[model samples]
Target: MTPQFGHFRAESGAGPLRAPMARWMIALVVLLFFSAPALARTAPDSFAELAERLLPSVVNISTTQTAEGQSGIEVPVVPPGSPFEDFFKEFFERNQPRQRQRRATSLGSGFVIDARGYVITNNHVIQDADEISVILQDESRIEAKVIGRDPKTDIAVLKVEPSDKLKPVRFGDSDVARVGDWVVAIGNPFGFGGSVTAGIISARGRDINAGPYDDFLQTDAAINRGNSGGPIFNLQGEVIGIATAIFSPSGGSIGIGFAIPANSARPVIEQLIKHGAVRRGWLGVRIQSVTDEIADTLGLKGVSGALVASVIDNGPAKKADIRAGDVILEFDGKPIDQMRKLPRIVAETEVGKAVDVKVWRGNKPVTVKVTVAALEETEEVAAATTRAPNETPKASIPGVGLAVAALNDRLRSDYGLDEDAKGLVVTGIDAGGPAAEQGIKPGDLIVEVSQEPVTTPDQMAAKVTAARESGKKSILLLIEGDAGLRFVALRLAAN
Candidate 1:
């Protein structure tokens, strides 16, 4: 960084001794004033003390994966009646390919969360391992067993029966950690046990799509392969985050590392220790972001909150009368300023506890009481993919740039829509129109226009006309496609 300085001068002529002293004091004051901000970002003198204290608590995790595989000793293919055929057959008899159980070992890093022998590491570390071992700083290895693990957050808690009390580090308040704060990471990178690296917190609340609960803390710390599940400590030596992933193309640390915030991982860890699984609060609603265009169509002051696409059948959201198109503004007393924040907030809510959910409906805020339910861990059937239809539609909707038609039995079969589906089916979309720009495809079903049901193309056109005549720049549309329901806002200016 470029150095910044301020100029200051002493008052003209006083006592000879006082004049020089005044200038020195004035310069000192100005320099400090100009340097305070940079001083706040200054790096620590050394991380040696912190690393030395933390190394004992951080451990190296070794996992052995035993898998059945055929040996690679290929038998030679000799031509019939060849001169060396007999020799080749005898040589290949003893060296025939055979099935073998191969044992593969991998190394990862974790920390001692409890002295009674509870270790914290990434789930992927010992996912299918036959044997797990934890190595401390003094090179002592102890056989460990998995207590519980949460694959969603990539966190796992292991149990190791140690003869002596283990050194453990407490979790720090990750919410109090600000971006640009200094952080230290101690882990076993590339099998180098107890390696320490230092960097600043680059960002927070990063959603890398790793899982539904993806509130990760990003740092520039040099975390590499064996660094997964390692502890990222603040200057006070408290674990503020757990290193889980890195953004690199070369399979090495490119200075972009992601860690699970201590505050976010704490509840999951505690639940795993108590119950073998995590019982997360579920609102049972499929949601999407309220984009700028959607905000304009809904007459919202600003773009915020998660837009409800579809409430699960007979789920908590449906029981609470939270319909599709409702924007979840606040949950349980916490304001949801962004769409992604709602999921994490809702999941952290206590299951079966009734909470007030403030939603945006009919151009106004409406609060509803909802009892959060435990999320059921089940696999959902994959929806079929959609493509443009070769056949033409019954009618074309004007002003909205959609060639929509009244849904028929034949169109329903072509689009692979539900047998009991309602509303208009999009047979064609204008290539250069507003609908195409907003990702309105040919096989999608238009369920609602401006929060009102539209059964036919003419009704959709009428809704578009009403929105345009009402001086609205855009019209809101709820579309149901293979990917599920989503709200789209198309501009009406081209009409």
Candidate 2:
């Protein structure tokens, strides 16, 4: 028989006056939860000592320009024929300035990259300035001169003669920086002198549509309008990236900031310092993504590379025996992971270096050694081959949207078919038919069906008839349009 108990369970002979274990359990649970985060917090380091060691390197950039100011100008119209108007008119007549404008001022941030007082900042920060000054952390301001500026990349270099040797910061390798690495940003945000914010690298190789070379290092560190051209430091306090832009609708810190990766900007900086401009190597080839259908058509095992749609004639690729149908698997020993990477690598490579290119052509792998050349505008190539003349239409199927015809030159030229094109033209598209729904319009060249090439009307009819006989609902047609080739999945209706 069970004994009746109220709101409690106990073993036989258990003690009734027991200390509560729930409070201890709750305390232990709370301790366990707070331990990890509390241990992860960084100890606060005094910036006064740190700034004393590094402040000599940091510089406050002030720029002034003679722009037409709306304020502090005497009114041009007479104020109720007051005597002051006559005084203003006489003053203006005496000073009759060639350029009627007042001076404007802007502030920004920069750092000395060289002991000789060579500093770096964004081009937009100091653009159109009549006067520029570099204020050191010691409250000593030196007049600066613009050495060079690159508007495309928004980088500028300035020179200031310091009375003493300036501490210079070296750029770190940004390519080795991974996500989750510790980073810090130092700049004059909102004109506040030498502010510092710390965070981890949020992402890498970010493209914010800023420039052609948009390999930005995304970070969560606070970056504002005046933060442009400031140094983004790694854990070693080396400059790894330049804080350039942020993506915040409110123009405040939403934790999304973009910095130009040192891997991309370092070379350009060197070029700018040496020659005052950047000269990127170009290949002059148009490329497209390697889709699944394209990979299958090319007999590639995986879709992991770029597809050469059309090689520019007399360009680097064409001069190096790179053909139209070649699928580039690797360039310069680096795997072509995506189509966008090709342009960046090609632009960074030396123009005269010999590059080894691996390509897939006709179900076989081939290696081509190509000497890179300078890019230029391409010229059109004349027709080298012609299509066979088309015979008249033999039959018009009742349900299908197509009128069949033999491959012909007249139809080929009219369709602007490719040199190797040999496809039966789709003469008509049935209204509300499967072909029409799949965007297979009239005069489209039907190149292949079910991965088999079709040239004549009888061949196309046989393929369709076989597909229907095989109990297939969808017929895949490789249609060639004015742009290029693409696959269309069409659902077959009941015959």
Candidate 3:
């Protein structure tokens, strides 16, 4: 019997082949219908709309500086046998001027942040420039005066008198920007104004060692020379960062660029505009990163927070009873995820404002109320004091793990200490003792024990015994090392 070519029958009249084929086709169609939107959402159709809207606010910055220096001339290399080499060298040398004064021009990028012609750019771009000019999108050039410049953050605020209200861009919350979020950079690359590039945020909180506040947003955008001080925008066309630097070996963009987050720049910019200077809060303490060894010694579960190395006398931290060897876990309710984060947080806080500081002390958490102070530009120098020489003999504190002697001329010469240094010289230390674990070396000078001056071994030993008798678990020793003066808290070993 002949069967139809297009149709098949199931065994025992169970079903026809067309029904199953029809169901499979329907399922495929449904999947395509739902997935069409997902495929379309992968990337934007074009960045034209966003670029057009943001270009008006972006400006090209041109700076000219009067440089007075000698200009060097390089002689072109020629074949050894070339007869004209000597003649050419002599002619160039005779004509070359030894010293000259000329105008050096540099180019950069910036964005208008206010309609009254307030612009923002990197401080390095206009540094030392005798004159500054801003070129708008329409090619209108306007001279700009420096409102303020902050070298620490590398931010500068400029003012220009435009004929009309200028286009300004607003800052977006860069804290919420994720690593893979799309970003657009508008800048004047290589003096070409109104240039645009797009990429995703490669990483966040990148420290390039540019400044004390080194938090930067790293991106893969094609940032090059003249792109410095430009704005990095998010998908909503809001400025999330300022393009400040690039990690390029060839002086060109290699898909690795860094931008200062808008969140960090906003406060600095506001202060620059308002007061022409930044007023940063200070805690007056020398802090170091909490290492694994330090964390273990402090009985901490994790290696997080900043470790207090020394506290400034009469400073906010000292006034609050925050002692040396305390690990600052949080500042102003913000978790200090790392040591570098604490300085930026404290600096951004308002001066004279009392904030709760959570620190890890003696294997426990302690909260102290500290009033932040205004950070001074000048550092405090410790005053040198003269102490009468003590004739006490050498003494050993067995539990404390150190043998000390008077700071005599012999000991000073042997240890290479300063001649005028007055302290108890540590002659020997137990390698496996608590003092050694706290990085105490044999040549370390014990200047003070529990805030009392100790010029001789007997004085230090007495202070240690007194501290132990008072039920103190640790004794704070002010030590002078090769680097400088610092404080070390050593656990009191059982007698």
- The reply for model 3, stretches above 4 Å from the true place, is 1-41, 69-99, 379-406, 413-442, 446-479, 485-495
Question: What are the clashing pairs of model 3?
Answer: none
Question: Between candidates 1 and 2, which one is better according to TM-score?
Answer: 1
Clash count, one per candidate = 0, 2, 0
lDDT per residue for candidate 1 within 323-358, as digits (tens), equals 999999999999888999988898888899999999
lDDT of 3: 0.87
Candidate achieving the largest TM-score: 1
TM-score list, all predictions: 0.87, 0.67, 0.74
Put down candidate 3 lDDT per residue, 51-110, tens digits, no spaces: 999999999999999988777777788888799889888888898877778999999999
The best-first sequence of candidates by TM-score reads: 1, 3, 2
Lowest lDDT sum, 10 consecutive residues, model 3, at: 3-12
State residue 35's C-alpha deviation in candidate 1, in Å.
15
Cα error of candidate 1 at position 361, Å:
1.0
Tell me, by lDDT, which candidate is best. 1
lDDT digits (tens) for residues 22-42 of candidate 2: 445555666777697746645
